[model samples]
Target: MNRIEKKLQSLQEKKEKAFITYITAGLPDMDHCAKLIRAQEEAGLDILELGIPFSDPAADGPVIQDASYRSILKGTNLRKCFELVDGVRKDGCELPIVFMMYYNTVLHYGLEAFAEKCAKVGVDGLIIPDLPLEEQQPLKDALAKQNATILIQLVAPVSGKRIPEILKDAKGFVYCVSSMGVTGQGASFHKEVISYLKSVKEQAQIPVMMGFGIRTAADVAPMKDIIDGAIVGSHFINLMEENQYDLDVAKAYIQTFKTELK
Candidate 1:
């Protein structure tokens, strides 16, 4: 099993929820980005999602969109993102790293080459939120050639009927979007969203995780029984922004989330 599957398996053994967090790669700059990346892993992240900054981030909220804008200004490209991953791996950080990027970047970089570079650099998976399940087969096939990076799929509320189809080639886990909106911590899962999540859990053989709008541990406390865990992004981004990108403060913030999870 890859790092992601292994980490989920370990969490399952401990009867604990998995924590997956994201940081836009090369946010302020590569140096500051590396610090936050390591800090998230140290904060007990089961999976670290590094957002590959894009000019047009269609699915991200203002927070992530702003971060991507800054990263773009710093000239963060696909190769540079890989370098960050390589640096983390060489430093002996075993935390699974998932590249949360958009489909346009993949197509621009060439799918096969992108997957090969990810495997060579020790990346564990990919989370392309904009890619539809019907169009994922080509990307999946490319990643399969390397047999290293896994494709993580997102299933929204309206996609309940297609759960089986979405999870058909899913790997790492199923990123069950809690809200249909872009992505922010302020978003909440209503009764209908929860009911939909429960239904998703019923069909997902792999770990079913909730993302988009889930900001705090309290938000996920009631969801443990219905979903595997929650994937947090905007919350941490807001924290880092509030703390002026202080890695220690953000690291401490993550521990607080974990404490609340308990």
Candidate 2:
């Protein structure tokens, strides 16, 4: 098993769900991004969904869109992201990092090139939000050859009857979106939604971690036993944005956020 598989296995043994955090690479700069990546593991981040900014991110909401813009302004690119991952690994952090990006970035970077670099740079998983399953076979085959980076897919309720087929080949935990809309903090966790998620978890062979629109600790309460974990992006990015001038504050907030998982 790769780092992520080992992590989920370990979490299952401890009866604890994974606490995944998302941050856009080079939000302020790669150096700052690197520091936060290291700090996240220290603050109990089980998985890191590191974003690679694209010129246009259709699935991203205003917060992440602004974050991508900031990262791009600071010169973030796929190459820089790989370099940052290399540095993070060298810094002795093995925090099951996954790249959450759009398919346009992959196409521009070349699918095989991206896969090869992910294997070399120690990325445990790759999530291309815009890549359709019908178009994923070639990319999936390429990643399979790379042998390290797992292709993580995002699923919403609208995926409908094909959920099982979509997850059959998933290696790492599947990312289940919390709502139908784009990433944000206003998503509801009502009983009906919780029931739907529990049903999805029942069908998934791999751990199902929900993301997008999931905002706070209270939001995690209802997902117990049903989801293996919760994935937070826009909420996380917003926290960092609020603390941008002082990373120390941002880092402390991350530690506090981890406490909410229980």
Best by lDDT: 1
Per-model lDDT: 0.85, 0.83
Question: In model 2, which regions exceed 4 Å deviation?
Answer: 189-191, 245-247
Please list all clashing residue pairs in model 2, or write none if there are none.
none
- Model 1 C-alpha lDDT per residue in residues 1-262, reported as the tens digit of each score: 8999999999889887888888989876898888778888888878888999999899999999999998889899988999998998898889999999999999999988998998998999888888887788898899889998898888888886788888776677889888877888476664588788888888888998888887788888777788888788988887788888998887787787776765
* Residue 109, candidate 1: alpha-carbon lDDT: 91
Instruction: For candidate 1, report its TM-score.
Output: 0.96
Superposed by TM-score, candidate 1 places the C-alpha of residue 201 at a distance from the truth, in angstroms, of: 0.3
lDDT tens string, model 2, 92-137? 9999999988887888788788889999989999888888888999
Which candidate leads in TM-score?
1
Task: Note each model's CA RMSD in angstroms.
Answer: 1.3, 1.6
